[model samples]
Target: MREIKVQLYRGEDDNYVELWKTVEKIEGKHRYYGRYTYGNEGTWYSVCDPLGYCELNAPMADDVMFICCDENGNEAIRYSNADGNKLPKFETVIKREWNKAKEKLQHNTEDLTKNFWAECWNGDTTMKINQWLLSYKDPDLYPEKANDYDENWTGCWAEKEIGYEPIPDTEFEYLGHKYQFTKVKHKHEYCGIEWYEFVCTDSPYVMRDTPWVNDRAWIQSYMYLGNWFDDKTYGTMYDQRSAREKVVAALIKKFPMKNKWDKLLYVKKKTGNEFYNCDCCYEKSYSDMADVLINRNYHRKDVDYLCKFINKETEGIVFASNRGNKYTIRQTYPDIYDYDNCLI
Candidate 1:
């Protein structure tokens, strides 16, 4: 989670200043709303729920609080404690803290973009990755633009395949500083690519600060395999089916295969130059090639990690072997290996 420090303009409520000035309180709603208002204004101030505007059944607004001020000392709003011990509102501390948050978010976004691009080429799109991207683009960075984007975005349009709403802004008290946080959400296009939106809030931060992203770990696990072992080219005009074939062909092309039988050896080959065969040869079943990938010590290390198709039907890993046949449960099961291991 990222953090940002804000100053309290005179006339801003003590509650508002206190709320927008902490580290912990700023991380929770980091990916949601950028707007934060106290419960003193009634539940009507809450964009947290879908109940519209109305007085909430919460407590008084004197617990912990803070005020927001522009660089010119224009007080925008006040944040206050509804039920917790009041926290202190420090101008310098808030500013310093928030600066760190912004840096982390920016770093995280850069890392996420690289991973996202790689996964797109692999025919897999994890929602967690998309959600992380939304957080990295935290709405606070582009409040006006994010709000405008949300106004037109239709989140979760196709079941859960689409995007989610902004995280919603919130405030909380910690170590005498009340922290304010904004949540962010995003929308996805028909191409399955995601774009961001914001839902500003006035709540406390919750998530802790951490390294933006683990680029080394990501590169070691994903980049290494894609670049070296899998023999899979990226950004090509192919979906899952076509992608599998291309990978298999890539494997064949690496060998000295000459005939159908030799190609079968290439298909079933585990490793070494012996596995190399002429490229002109073909195999009767694509499964023959899959068997090679499945058996190899190198590919096996992370093959299942890359192949997300494991299920009761296609068995083993979801990778497309040979020509894409031999889909069954038995072959791919956790504790079995043989021709009958797969159902198909």
Candidate 2:
């Protein structure tokens, strides 16, 4: 079991910030069921049966903190203590936190136009290669291995593909920086020939931040820490417009009309639904057109991440229909059992 987490603030009554916040729709008359704690009450030691009855006879749940409403519903929980420590409505906290997540999700997409190249392999991403060479050789792991062919110590050491022949190591002075070159190959053949290819070592930021993609690259790969020995996902990074963006971009392209009247409202999905809306929810009415972002394409494993699909634009362009971000809304909700393209 994971350790129970508690958050203590100096001024306010201590709150169980780690508690799982849930939502309960209130009907005519409702019963309450769950475990809870009062002011300075350490944790959820008090249990209440259904029908809003706090018998206070149940034992303390030392392991976890929860407030679950049963199938019958009516699990309204209002916890307080002698010292006046009180928790707001269960879903209230849930909404507050959810809003922060929603805001981050909606705005997380960066301008994919920048070419993240390494002027020098000195930063966190690039120095790693320097460190690797330092371990094997005293001063520098020159492209000596890069110039020759040997499985043990070479730039593309781990790639044992039969056909690939290591080209001689070449370097030149460019703006007072040395850029090393190893065997470069096309990721995949295009139109029966290799057309577009970019170079970055096993890991991004090794020599330069590699091009997994900048809106055009597919789900390409890089080694873990630029080291071939480490286990890694095939694609370290990738890029393409989102399913919704693809839809909108395509609509603007296909049905091109000059004026406002000709502008087709192709999108059917707009934000503002209960599963994501916590405020309009529980309340009598909901916010009109709640523009909360539903997902942030992030690589959950490392900080450099994307929660979006690994499919290239050509592959995911089908979503360029009425998907309108709403498609991701359905697939990327936090609690979904099987989230499509969920990097988990």
Candidate 3:
């Protein structure tokens, strides 16, 4: 008997993995079942059978080619059946599914409005008048270093007054006197759904014009990805005395924001590894526009659906340099571009 395990992004589905009994039809295909790890990270799996043959269909973009391993975790066999067995062709099927899923993932009425607010608010701090704090750390330090304001308040104010310069108290001392070392600055922007025009509903005369509520119904300011908006202003300042230092920094800065905790009170999904800090303004100000770009589905078709929805709604605002949620199908899956087994 030939045993096979089918998986969707490494999922345990019998339909995807076809198995054929030794006495059963060998010319036709069969389905098998198994599982890989969960979450956005990568995963691996193995399968061992008394019988030696198992063939697989073409894998999707995110699907990694399986490698059968021995008990000691060494590579054993290629993830295919006999030498004569062949994989399925996915060019036509993948393209068809891609188009269909893309259309299906289009945001609903609520989603359209909510996603718009999230994108707008994530750009600048329009939630609270003109006050814009890069990240929560900036606002938290505001109260502590408020008394240390020594520069002339008349001018635009030095970087110190605006919470950009390093505070003496928060510094680490090294040589003679007080040495102020490097501090990680988490940069971000904030705004809200009200800034846009389409979200409004009621008549201009009767409805109240408040920043929080508009005709289009705003989506609250919920935190998205971390360091997605970092401006790289945390580097050494030439003017400061102790500006130079050899240090390692995470390409993606990680700063804990306050609003994230408050938002959790309203939305119960803020627990565990899912909680990402908000970048709106400086402090923790919960607005009515929040959402994430990540699609928590295992299927490549499903992921493509969510990406298409984003592409349509954002109107090209979704890029690493441009505004809104930044993402790439390539980053998540390299196999999607392969011609023979592509899943795009």
Winning candidate number (TM-score):
1
Provide the lowest-lDDT 10-residue window in model 1. 219-228
Following a full C-alpha superposition, what root-mean-square deviation does model 3 have from the true structure? 29.9
Number of the candidate with higher lDDT, 1 or 2: 1
User: Residue 122, candidate 1: how far off, in angstroms?
Assistant: 5.3
Candidate 3 lDDT (Cα, whole model)? 0.25
Query: Tens digits of per-residue lDDT for model 2 on 192-220?
Result: 11211122222211323335533232222
Q: List model 1 lDDT by residue over 1-344, tens digit each.
A: 22233342121233331122222245463211122234322211222331222222333334334344444444544454443323223333344444544443421222445546645664323333332223222234434434333212223331112222222233333333344534333233322333332222224323322255331111001010000011222212222223344445544544434554543322122234434432112233443564444442212223433244323312323333333333333233323323332323
**Range of the 10 consecutive residues with the lowest summed lDDT in candidate 2:** 281-290
Give Cα-based local distance difference scores for all models.
Answer: 0.32, 0.27, 0.25
Off by over 4 Å in 2: 1-166, 169-180, 184-246, 253-344
TM-score of predicted model 3? 0.16
lDDT at residue 288 of model 2 (Cα atoms): 11
Most accurate candidate by lDDT: 1
lDDT of 2 at 215: 28
TM-score of each: 0.21, 0.17, 0.16
